[model samples]
Target: MRFHVLTLFPEAFEGPVRHSMLGRAIQRGLLSVQIIDIRSYTHDIHGTADDYQFGGGHGMVLKPEPIFDAVSDTLSPYPTRDRHAFPVVLLSPQGRKLDQQLVLELATAPGLVLICGHYAGVDERVRTHLATHDISIGDYVLTGGELAAMVIIDAVSRFTPGVVGAADNVQEDSITSGLLQHPLYTRPSDFHGMTVPDVLLSGHHAQIDRWRREESLRRTLENRPDLLDSADLSLTDRAFLAGLGYVGISSLLDDGFESQE
Candidate 1:
């Protein structure tokens, strides 16, 4: 897959795109990142891409003309049908929160056009008329969308074929799995006072699997209980969690979890 990043600061992406798995993916021709300077599309002498808000806002808003023109010029070579289905994502705090599901969805697209909003934010027209997806990395705000665009690229790239070492491992990742992952342990079974779980040392695959399952449940219950609401649970899994005081969804079905009842 290909990612066309539209940003005022194209230089910010140089280091990131040349290192880590993203770099490896590019080296192997599995993925590609093209950085486009929004300023390059501006018609002004100074290449002005941002301007003072019309309603007298505190910060300057990114102009719509440059962004629209940039996107048009970037996708001009693609077929008409392909351009219509292309994803033009705008990074913003007010957008839908990014998650593993969204990353997976974006991976299905042949390419992505990411617009990095800066200063106050992108002009409203870009959000309403041009962008197909408006996404936020988290609830917190950032100084610019450059970092968020990198994050989206990394997250979505992991879903691309051959990007990660084991493609199936991505599915079992912490949030992608729909629950927190189980603890991981490597060589050196004994680390001072801490020791690896005995079940892991044993050669019993069934027992080891069971231990991992329960550990994952235990960790999720302690760290993120909200995930339990939609997590896939079996009778054995529910019973295991119930012993640890986690209320299963089925148990709450009769009363609907209302404390009064």
Candidate 2:
């Protein structure tokens, strides 16, 4: 897959794109990232990319012409109307919240073009006419969108084939499976009076799997109970959770699990 990043500060990406999984993906030819400086498209001697807002905003707003030109130039080689064509996404707090599902959806795309807004924000025209999607990492705002773009790239890249060392491990990632992952322990099974769970050391595969599933459920219930509403739960799983004192969804609704506070 390919990713094109449009930002005023292309240098901001140098460190991240050159290290870790993203770098390895690039080396293996499984992923490609092109950093395009938005200022490059500007016609001014100063390569100006932003200016005062129309109605007088507190900060400068990204100019529309340069952004539009950059996106158009990038897509000029492909059929823009095709569904398989790359997506032009703008990073902003107003966009749909980024999540595991969104990451998976973007992974299916042939490529992505991310616009990292700075100062006040990108002009509304760019969002209305150029971008195919607007995405946010979370509820909070950032000084700039460069960090958000990097996050989106890393998360989406994990789903690309051969990007992660063990593809199966991605399926077991926290939140990817709609639950927190079970605890993991390595060598020194016994340490400072703390011993590894006997089930893990017993060479009992079936029991190990069972223990993992139950522990995952217990952790999710304790840390993020809200996820259970949409989590894939079978009858047996529900029975097991009930055994751990968690109210069944049906019972919760029927009796109204009111907060003691």
Candidate 3:
């Protein structure tokens, strides 16, 4: 798959997209990233891409013309290349919360068009008419959308078909299961004062599966209980959770949880 990024600081992406899994994916031809400098599309003499907000905002808002032109030029040959018009994703704090399901969905898209906003934010016109999706990494605000775009690009790219080491491992990831992942241990099974769980070393697959499931539920119940609300619990999973003192979803939503009913 291909990803086209529209940003004012295209140089910031040079080092990142060339290293680690994203780098490997690009090298292997499993993923492709094209960075387009929004300033390059600007018509002004100074290559300006932002202007003072009409209502008098504290910071300048990203101009819509350059962003629109950048996307238009980037997508002009998509149909001819057997690629669909990729979803235009605007990074914003007010957007839908980014999650595993959304990552999975985007990983499967033919391509992605990411617009990184700066200063105050992108103009509302760009959000309303240009972007097809808006995503937020979390509740807090960042200085710019570049970091959020990188976060998303890394997460989504790793799951794209041939980008990762194992397809099955990717599918069995923590959030995809709606539960925290079971502990992982590699060589030197003995570390510090801890030893690897015997079930893992015993070559007993059934027992290992059971242990992993129990541990997954336990970890989820402790660390991120809100996950239980949407978890696809099986009969065994429900029974295991019940045995661990989990009464229901509401009882686990908050940290230091307590139930009245």
* TM, every model: 0.92, 0.91, 0.89
Q: Please, what are the lDDT tens digits per residue for candidate 3 over residues 61-91?
A: 9999999999989999868554454788999
Best by TM-score: 1
Q: Estimate candidate 3's RMSD in Å.
A: 4.2
**lDDT at 66, model 1:** 96
The lDDT per prediction is: 0.89, 0.89, 0.87
Clashes of each: 0, 0, 0
Error of 3 at 251 (Å): 14
Model 3 residue pairs with clashes: none
Evaluated at residue 201, the lDDT of candidate 3 is 100
Better of 1 and 2 by TM-score: 1
Model 1 over residues 1-261: C-alpha lDDT tens digits? 999999999999999999989998999999999999999999989999999999796999999999999999999999999898789999999999998779889999989999999988989999999999999999999999999999999999988889999744887889788789999998899999699999999989999989988999899989998888888877677777777765545553332332222
